[model samples]
Target: MVTEELYAKDSYIKNFSAKVTKIVPSGVILDRTAFHPRGGGLESDTGALILGGNTYRVTEVKFEGNEIVHVLEKLDGLREGDEVEGRIDWERRYRMMRLHTASHIIASIAFSKYNALITGGNITPEYAKDDFNVENKDLLPKIVEEANEIAKRGIKVKVYFLPREEAMKIPGVVKLAEKMPPELETWRIVEIEGIDIQADGGPHVSNTEEIGSIEVIKVENRGKGKKRLYYTVKP
Candidate 1:
């Protein structure tokens, strides 16, 4: 059976309970989970599982087809059909959440000002890098400044689902230059109030103000038409 992804609807869930549905050499599969699998440029979550007072350190989380695999440091006591309580590392997760939201703000402002589309990127607990299909490197500062300004506005961030056809109609719903959202009947949309909205599947802060100030660490030129902006969030 496919595991229920609780984070899709609520990104703030740090602790949860679920039953072990399957066990393999790689990891254990839970019936429901809040752990976000490593994908879409966002890192996987790390946490611990409690079973009969024994704690299993979850080193990595990933999606194998429809199953959510929780890779643990030791699986000695966990068994299929057993119950477990999982807790994600809040400090790390919160940092990532701030970076993720900051990335969105940067992307949105860049797109509106320069008509740039995101080519690729990575978000981690310490920093975030977003690649754009723009040749002008000088625009980086303006984009960063605008993003920080938006974050200071304290706009609320909203997440919801919409039909694929309807979502595609929005002017800038799909912001990635090379990637299209999965071919699903419905798409998950993240809207940064009146500033920006796009199709995304990662945990984010509830408001832009939670992102604090976004500081540009550096910019890299990755060949022609590709520029990556490296940044970090400061509280």
Candidate 2:
């Protein structure tokens, strides 16, 4: 078994084709793929796989142990050794990338300004969210304005891999997770220059400027010291 290559990192793999090696209830397995599996609260890629002049709609992209699964609409004539052309819904993907990156910007800014720690997050094509440590309810309006300003500045967003030992040496890398992320020696790190950075695995926009209007839609106190923020970045 081999770990599937998550194409979200590249953010520019427009198309691909692969041979089917296995089939299951949710989706079929391909030798390779450009579709992203569901993880990190980001939705999976949805598109079409064209084979033998027939197109199978890919409804969900997921992982089964080590194999990448492409769930599809029931269609006739799918079998082993078949070659299929995969196409990603770029418009939707682009939105998700922007939203995902914006989440980082907000998280970075909030963490630094308030010395808060993130407890959880959820990202979707239309919007994204984060839970932060909050001291009082009076700060909602102020935090929202600051986050929107960060997005408007369009700071640089870059990705890089750090050696595990070297990564631990970095000032902001969190070593507190119950299980550190896998392949962290080659950690896919996201950096909003002069702002925020973290070990992340998901699609992101190349520049912070691409994140158009960022709106802090809502904020609520989930419990003691925790605040949840619901946000959407303008496309």
Candidate 3:
């Protein structure tokens, strides 16, 4: 059965109660979850599940088809139909939220200034990186400046589902050059008000102001026409 993904609706949900539906060698499957499975160039959420007064550490989370599986350090006493309380590592998750939002801001800035498209990206609590299809690495400093300017604007970030056809019509909605979002009737779109809008299914902060400031840590030349920017958000 497909797990009801609470994270998709609310990235701020840190804890949730769920009933175990299945148990595998590695982990257990829940009927619903706020734990985000690893995908979309983002890392998975890790924490603990409390069951029968015992805590099991969630080492990993991933999608097995449409089902969300929570890999545990040990299955122990968990069983089907068992109810448990799941908690996410909020400190880490929040960092990623800020980083993910910051990446979008940087991507938007790159596109606006140089017409660059996002070739790739990865998000982590420590730092985030995005690759853009641009030739000149000299624009790194300028891009960083523009990104901070936008972040200081305190733009309101909004997430909503739109019909695939309508979402595609919005310019700059699909910034990734390598792949397209899953083919679904309604696509989840994340928008930073006037700054950026793109088809995304990942956790993000409610406002750009939450991102504080982003520092460009490194710029790399990944062969012709590929420029990579690595950045970290200040607490």
Candidate 4:
């Protein structure tokens, strides 16, 4: 099934209409959607799926066997073939977009300056953190300062889908593990023009300047010689 990634193509899409195609035990699947699924350190989108003048609040969205399920507070009168409008809570989404973009910059800069590896990460509307293999925790302040300097450049963000064969050609793109699903013909890649690039699946702002002031707040030594850096931006 073709999942329409509204966030990838149009980060600003607030409202859209789709037909209910499948109803499962967990939720209802729409033919197309603007609701973002929970994954890649980003929270699931929350909003409403409207149909026939009735509003059903959307609580979560995810893919189930090629179908996009839009979990609701209550199913109400929603049914297959019914056309519904997918509305995103833009205020929340835009904040995530900004934070997510800031995160990429932080990781990108770290790679360039410290030769560190981002082991893991978590994202929220206002802030996000990335785990890294730092040689010296004391140098974190320098990392933050460097990341902030790059953030100030207000770099532009661009995203694209690459076929597995073509995507493997980029030096920065790392495939950490063997393919779990052979069905995935392509991978989503995020790139900061002239700076960094990674295979990622998340929403981001059009420009790095939109990230505002990224403050690297806390850095913790999480054992095994790995460190976690937490951060937020000042509006």
lDDT of 2 at 60: 89
Residue ranges of candidate 4 with Cα displaced over 4 Å:
175-183
Q: Taking the candidates one at a time, how many backbone clashes does each contain?
A: 0, 1, 0, 0
Candidate 1, pairs of clashing residues = none
Name model 2 segments beyond 4 Å from true. 1-8, 138-141, 174-179
- lDDT per residue as tens, model 1, 48-153: 9999879999999998886789999998977899999989988888999999888888888888888998999998898989899899887987899988888999
- The residue-by-residue lDDT of candidate 2 on 120-232, one tens digit each, is 77788888877777767556557667766877786888888777787767765652224366764477777888877777778888887888878878888899987788888
| Cα-based lDDT at residue 111, candidate 1 | 86
Model 3 TM-score (2 dp): 0.97
CA lDDT scores, all candidates in order:
0.90, 0.77, 0.90, 0.77
TM-score of each candidate structure, all chains considered together = 0.98, 0.89, 0.97, 0.90
The TM-score, computed over Cα atoms with residue i paired to residue i, of candidate 2 is: 0.89
- Model 3 lDDT tens row, 1-235: 7799899899999999999999988899999999988998899999999997799999889988877889999987888999999999999999999999988888888887788988888988899888889999978768888888988988899999999999989998888886788889999999999989999999999999999889988999999999898889896
